[model samples]
Target: MKKLLLVLAALLVAACAHAPAQSAKEAGAKTERNFSPAHVKEVIVKGKTTQKEILAKIGTPNSVKRRSLGVTTGPAEVWNYWTAPPLNDVAKGGLQPVTSLAVVFDDNGVVQDYAAADSSVLIQ
Candidate 1:
């Protein structure tokens, strides 16, 4: 009886641990965001574009984070935008494909740098 109880307890703990990952996977599988790389390139410029300009041109970012640039530059803000394949594709997938853009801004709210990645190309 004690051995059986121990096994049941372990199984319960494993189920609890797995619940969050399953939830996250389901969430990702349902996410849909889309944007054009050409538009981003035309509007966002390093050392010139301000946060407000980006907002006006591209709309709101999906996420924002505050992070350290380096010891010399101190902290900076990062804005992230992304485009992902449809939920149907993601749900059927081995690896989910996405296109993403990250914009870094200085303390003065001017863009410092930006990068974009398109994983859809890899699948094609």
Candidate 2:
């Protein structure tokens, strides 16, 4: 009986250790609004997009900011999105993951530049 119990416990531990990590897709499926990393990457890396195009593609940004009213500067737009950390690290006290997508547009409303920032330490 002791040996059988030990074997079952070992198997349970091994099974959990080898389980696949939960991705953002799995967690976000339960929410009303969810944007995957791939979706965010597509817009930021693609060329010459507009505000309407962005909204149609990635939904509304989490937040938006405009340049100072009087300052003469190129018009720009920024978008922010966040995802929960993978399950493997959540129990280990990992930081909640976030992704920021910034799309800068010229005064004429043409995509001038774009950037994506991730909270993963490995990315930096």
Candidate 3:
């Protein structure tokens, strides 16, 4: 049994070793890094954009949440994305405030509201 387990582990490691590496564009590893306070304004707009548009602008969200609230007049879908400087930029002695953006969509996937929280939680 121990030998079987070892063989399985070896196979797993070999499979992982052969997997293709992720490229920067495919990874979207903070390609739009080091956003200023005004950057969110330029990207996200409430009641005028759709979830599809947001995805196109921001690539992929870190998370997506959906809930059916009993309330009749609020968002039912939420998409979250985080912004921070790349390591190189951070090493240059610049301030990189980590910010989280939550975009809420109605039943129809149209953006209803959005909020950005900084290390200081700048609600706009």
Q: Judged by lDDT, which candidate is best?
A: 1
Question: Candidate 1 vs candidate 3: which has greater TM-score?
Answer: 1
Error of 2 at 37 (Å): 6.1
For candidate 3, lDDT tens digit of each residue in 1-124? 5434444554564444342456877666536542234666788677788877776666556667887557666568887766544434434433455677778898888888887777732211
lDDT of 1 by residue, 14-85 (tens): 444332233665565643334467767888778999999887676567677886446446437888876544
Answer with 1 or 3, whichever has the higher lDDT.
1
State the lDDT of candidate 2 residue by residue for 1-124, as single tens digits.
5434444554564454442455798546533433545665665444567777776566555555666778777565554443444434443443456565666666656667766666652211
What pairs collide in candidate 2? none
TM-score of each: 0.58, 0.49, 0.54
RMSD of each: 11.7, 14.0, 11.6
Model 2, residue 11: C-alpha shift (Å) = 39
RMSD in Å for model 2: 14.0
Residue 90 shift from truth in candidate 2, angstroms: 6.1
| Model 2 clash number | 0
Per TM-score, the best of the predicted structures is 1
C-alpha RMSD of candidate 3: 11.6
**Which segments of model 3 are wrong by more than 4 Å?**
1-30, 33-37, 69-73, 83-96, 120-124
Name the runs in model 1 displaced over 4 angstroms: 1-35, 68-72, 94-97, 121-124
Give per-candidate clash totals: 0, 0, 0
